[model samples]
Target: MHGQPPNILFILIDDLGAVDLASFGSTFYATPNLDRLAERGLVFTDAYASCPVCSPTRGSLLTGRYPARIGLTDWIDFGGRIQPARGKLVDVPYIRELPRTEVTSASLLRGRGYSTWHVGKWHLGFEETYPEQHGFNVNIGGGYLGAPGPGGYFSPFDIPNLPPGSPGQYLPEVLTDEAINLIRNRGDNPFFLNMCFYLVHTPIEAPADRVAKWEARVRELGLDRRTALVEGEFFPMEHKRHLRVTRRILQSDPVYAAMVESMDENVGRLLDTLEEEGIADDTLVVFTSDNGGLSTSESSPTCNNPYAEGKGWMYEGGTRVPMIAAWPGRIPAGSRTAEPVCSIDLFPTWLAQAGIPVPDRLLIDGEDLSPVLFEGAALERDALFWHYPHYGNQGGTPGSSIRSGDWKLIEFYEDHRLELYNLAEDIGEVHNLAEEEPEHTRALHQRLKEWRGSVAARIPTPNPNWQE
Candidate 1:
C-alpha cells in the first residue's frame, strides 16, 4: 500500500504452543500486546511449523523448502547432550548445518537492497553458517546456541555475539532494545527484522517480580488446587525409558507465565517503537512460533489441551502453532483464516511482497500466500506433510504424517502402524479412525508415502542395540 516496499518484521518464538497467547486461547498467560496485534491483523488458526523441532522449522522458514527436502530434518544439537534416543529404530543422520548453497529469504531480500537484521536465536548452524553468512546485514545474539546460555535468561548470557549487560538484565528486553535501535537508525531502505525470542523455552526462568505476580494470580484463580501434571506410559526412547511421560494438565505455571508476560511486554515495546518512529503503517509484522509448546516433558510447562501431545510428535499439538500477520493497509484487520499454512510459506511470501521473482532452477516447496494474506482468499493445495523419523526427547515415536483437507493420517515407522483422524471431528485426535475408515486411511497413507519418496526422505533403520 505504500509507494516504497513495506518493511518486514518477523517475530518467531521458540516452543510456543498453538493457544499459548491470550488472543489464541490461553486463560493463564497474559499477552495483551499480542491480543491487540491479533485484533489489528489476520489470525491463522491452522498454521503449522514445517517440523516439530527448532532447527528444521527455522531452516524451512528461510529456504521455502521442507526439512526433508533440505536434508536438515531435526533440531541441530551443538552441545551433543540432547542426542536422539534410539530403541527399535536408530535415528538417521541429518545435515548439521544449513548449506550455504541454498537461497534464503534473507539473501534474496538483501540482494534487493533491503536491510536484513537477525536478532536472537540462530540455531540453524555453527560459526561457518551464521545469519551474516545467510544474507543478514547485522546478526545480534545469534549463534549455535538455541536457548539462553549458561546464565539462562539473565545477564552474562554467554552468547558470544551479544555484549555483556547489567547483572540482572533480561534476555528478551535486551534483544528488543537491539531491534528497536535497528529500526530507529534504518535509513531510506526497507528492512527485514527477524526477531527470534528464546522465551517460553527450557530454563523457564523469569523476572522475580513478574513470577511473584503470577504466583499470586494462580492462587487467586484457585488453579493451584487442581491437578497440574499427570504421569503416563513409559517413554518410547531407550535413554528415558526409566522415566514415565509427564504431561502438564493445567496452564498455571507461574514462572512460565512470567516468561510469557515478559515476551509480551517486549513485543509491545517493538510495536510501540514502530509507531513512535512513524513506520507502523509501512511495516508488515508477522508473529509465529517454531513449534508447539513443551507440554509432555522437561517440566511440562504449558498444556496444549484440545490438541493431544506436544512438540516432537507428529500430532497437531506438535506442529500446529500460532500465526498472526499485521500490515496496516494490506492485510485486513481482525481477520481469521483456517487455510492451513506452514513455516515454509514465509520465504515465498517475503519474496512476493518485495516484488522479486523466484530464481530459475531453484526448487521451493512453499506456495506464495499473497492472495490469502492480502485478498482474503483460500490456499489451493492438496495437503501438508511432516516427517520425523526419530524418537523425540519427549515421549514420541518415529513417524510421518499427512493432513489432507480435514483428514490426518500418521504412520509410525517402528511397527508400520497407521492412525487416522478426521481433524474436523476430533481436534484432540483421541478417536483413531484408521480401522473405522479403511478407504480414507489407505488413500492418505499412499499419498504420504509417495510424497516422502519424492522428497527422498530418510527412514530410520532397526537398531541392533535394542534388547526388548
Candidate 2:
C-alpha cells in the first residue's frame, strides 16, 4: 500500500506448446514478437498450469484454488450433443459456470481501486458467472460456452461459437482494440487488464489470404493436401471423429505454426498499446498458457511435447507451461528460471503484487510467489499435487500426478494403474520406476492417499461392465 499500484496486463495463450515458438527452438515458425518480448523480460522454463485442462487451469489462475476444491474437477463440459445412457456425449465443458461464492482475480483487483477489463475468450462458465460478475468491470464477448468465438480467420464468427463479439472483425483484433481503448480511457490510477487471447487454440480459422498462402507453400512441397498444412498456421482438423489423424495433422500441416504466428501478431499489438499509453514502466505484463497442446485425435487433441499426454492428463507436458513476466526495471530481462510454480500460486501472487491481501475466507491452496518474483525469494515445497476425477477433451484420459523435486507419481484410478517417473532423467515419462523404486513410490502413494482423503473429490460411480 505504499507506491501506486502497478497496472497489470495478463496475456494468456491457449494450447501453445513450448517447442512451437521460435524462441523456444522451432525454426519452422517465426514468432518475432514473442522472441522480442522474451528478450526484454523474464521467461520461466518451469511454470505450470495447476490442471491439465482448460477451465480447471483457468480457475486456478484466477482463484488460486485447485479445480477439485471448487467443484470443477473436469473440463467445463456442456452444450454440444449429449447421448443418453452411453454418457459419451459432446458438450462445451470449458464454459462451466463457476459458483458465486468463489472469489476471483478480477474481483480482487477491482476492489483494490483498479479499473479492470476482460477481453478474448472467457471459457470459465456463463454470464451469471461471467468475468463481469467475477471482478472485471468490463467483459467483452465472454459467454458460458466452449469457444470465445470461431477459429477461422476470415469469418471467425461463422462457427457461431462466441458470436456476441463485434461482427465481421478478426477476434484478435477486436480484443486488442478493446484493450487499447480501455488503456486510453483510464487516465491513470493504475489498472488490471486481462488480455486472454483465444488464438493459437483451435477452430483452424485462418484469414483467407493467410490460408491461401499456406496452401500454395504446401503444394510447392508436394505434400499430400489431406494432412498438409501451409507452413505457419494451424488448419482445423476437417473431421471430428477421426481421432487417430490428429498427430498426423499437427506434424504434417503447418496450421499449428500459423495459428501461433497469428497469436504473436496480436501480442505485439497489445504491447504497442501499452507503450502508447506510457505505462510500460509501471505495468507487469505476464504471458502464459491455459494448458498443453492437442495430442489425442483429429476431433480433440493437443501436443504435450516430450511428455506422453496432452491437456486433460496431469503429465509435465500438460501441466507445465511457459510463464514470462515483464516489469520494465524490476524483473531481469532475458532471464529464465526453472523453479517450479503452479497455477494456484497466481492467486496470492497477484494480490500481493497489487498490495491487496486475499481474504482469509478464500482458503486458497496456493503460496505467494511475489517474493520469488520481486525479491529473488526461495521456493521450497514438499510437492505439488493434482486430482482430476473426471475425463475431458484432451483424451489423455484421467489421472492425478504429484511432483516433488525430480520425482513424479501418477495415479490412474479408472484403470487402477499407478506409475512413477523420474522427470529429471525421463521427460517423456517413458520409464515406470515404481517397481524399482518401491520405497519412494510407496511414500508418494501414501501422501497422495492422505491428500485425497482430505479433499471431498467426487467419487466416479464404477461401471460394473467397465472391463467389457
Candidate 3:
C-alpha cells in the first residue's frame, strides 16, 4: 500500500442495473472495461442502492444514511419533468435539496486534505447546495437537472459548470475527460473523484455509429426477432393511469445498448488514465450505480431479469445494483462476495479506508464493509432498509422495504399490503410468502415498522382526489 492516503475514484452510473455489465450476467450489453474491472476487483453480488430512484440513492451514498433518515426520499426533478402526481396516497413532502448541515463524504474528505471533485449529475440540490457548497473543490457538468439538459447528452450540452464541447460530443466522454484531467493534474495530495456518469439514463440517444453497431450485433445474434418489451399492469399513479407498465423482457434495445457501451468505453478511458498517470496502484476504484436500470418505464431501456421488476418497484431488480471495488494490494483481486451492502455503506467504507475517524455525533446508518471488502469476512449487520414514500415514475407505489439475511419484506403504503420473499429461493420475487409464513412475515414487518420509527420516515397519506 502507498504511504499516502490512496486516491479514491468513485464511478457512479446513473441508471445501471445489477446485471448490466458483461461481468454481471449481461449477455447482450458489451462492457469489456467493466468486465476487466470486475476481474481486478471484488464483485458484490447482493449490493443494493438505498432507493429505487436516483436522488435518494445518491444522497444515501454521500451521507452514509438512509434516504428516509435524511428526508430526501424522491428524485429531485428541477426540469419540471416530474410534478405532483396524484396517486392512491399523496406523496410525503421531502427535502428538495441536500441539507447544508449534513456531513457528506466530500465534505469530510475535503476537511482531511483530500482534493474532492464531483463531475456530472449533482441533482441533490440547486445552485446554492451544489457540489461546491457540499465540499467539492471542482464541479463539472453537475446541476439541479437530473438528466442532461436541453442538449440531451450531446454537445451544445446545457449542463451547469461544464463548458460545451464540440458539436455532437457525447456527455459521458466529456465528463470523463474532465475527470481524467483532474487525475493527471492532481498534485502530491491524494484526491477523491466522485465521477458520476450521466449515461444509460433518459433521452437514451447515442452516437449513430455505436447504435448501428449494436443494432447489427442484435441481428447477428438472432435477437432482433425476439420480443423486447411486454405490457404489464396500469401505472399506480393517477397522473399516468392511462398508460400501462412496459417491461423490457430482453436487453436488445440497440440504442440503449449503445449508451451502455459508450458508458463502458468511458470507464475504460478512466481506468487507462489511472494507469497512464502511474496511480493505478495508489487509488481505490469503486464502480456502482445510483439506482437499478430503467426497465419498467421511460422507454423500458434495459432488462434486469432473474431479479424481477426494475428501477421503481421495491423488487430485487429495482434496488439491487452492481458494485465492484478495486484497490490494488488492499482489496483482493478477483474476489466475490454475496454479502448484502447498500449505497449507504460507501461513506463509512471510504472513511474507514482513508483512516478518517467518524464523529460520534453522526448517526450513520451505514456500516463499514472493510472486513468484507478486504478480508472476505462476513458483513455483520441485521438488516438493510429502504423507505420510498412516493409513487415511482416507473409504476411502483409508495412503500418501505427491509432485507434481513435471505428474507426480504416490503410494505406498500397505498393499501398497507405486505410482501415477503425469500430471496435465496426466489431471486425473481415472483412468489410472495407473506401469508405462507405468518410468523416470519410478522417479525420482519415489525422490524420494518420499528426501523421507520427510528428513522422517523414519513409515510404517504391517502389521496383525497382518488375516484376509485
TM-scores of all candidate predictions against the true structure: 0.99, 0.87, 0.98
Query: TM-score of model 3 relative to the true fold?
Result: 0.98
Q: What would the per-residue lDDT of candidate 1 be over residues 1-468, giving only the tens digit for each residue?
A: 337878999999999999899888998899999999999999999999999989999999999999999999988887766565688998988998899998999999999999999999999888889999999999999999878989899997798699978899999999999999999999999999999998878999998999999999999999999999999999887888899999998899999999999999999999999999999999999999999999999999999998899998899989999999999887899999989999999998999889889998789899999988998898888799999988888788889999999999999999999999998989999999999999999999999999999999999999888987
Q: After superposition, how far is residue 208 of candidate 2 from its true place, in Å?
A: 2.4
TM-score of 1: 0.99
Between the candidate structures 1 and 3, which one is better when assessed by lDDT?
Answer: 1
Model 2 over residues 206-311: C-alpha lDDT tens digits? 5666656656665666654455221222221112223332342343344655667678888888888888878888888888888866665433323445666566
lDDT against the true structure, each candidate = 0.92, 0.69, 0.90
Where's the lowest-lDDT run of ten residues in candidate 1? 76-85
Highest lDDT among the candidates is held by which one?
Answer: 1
How many clashes (backbone N, Cα, C below 3 Å) per candidate? 0, 32, 0
Candidate 3, residue 2: Cα displacement in angstroms equals 7.6
Q: How accurate locally is residue 126 in candidate 1, as Cα lDDT from 0 to 100?
A: 87
Q: Estimate the TM-score for candidate 2.
A: 0.87
Off by over 4 Å in 2: 80-95, 148-168, 215-252, 299-302, 465-467
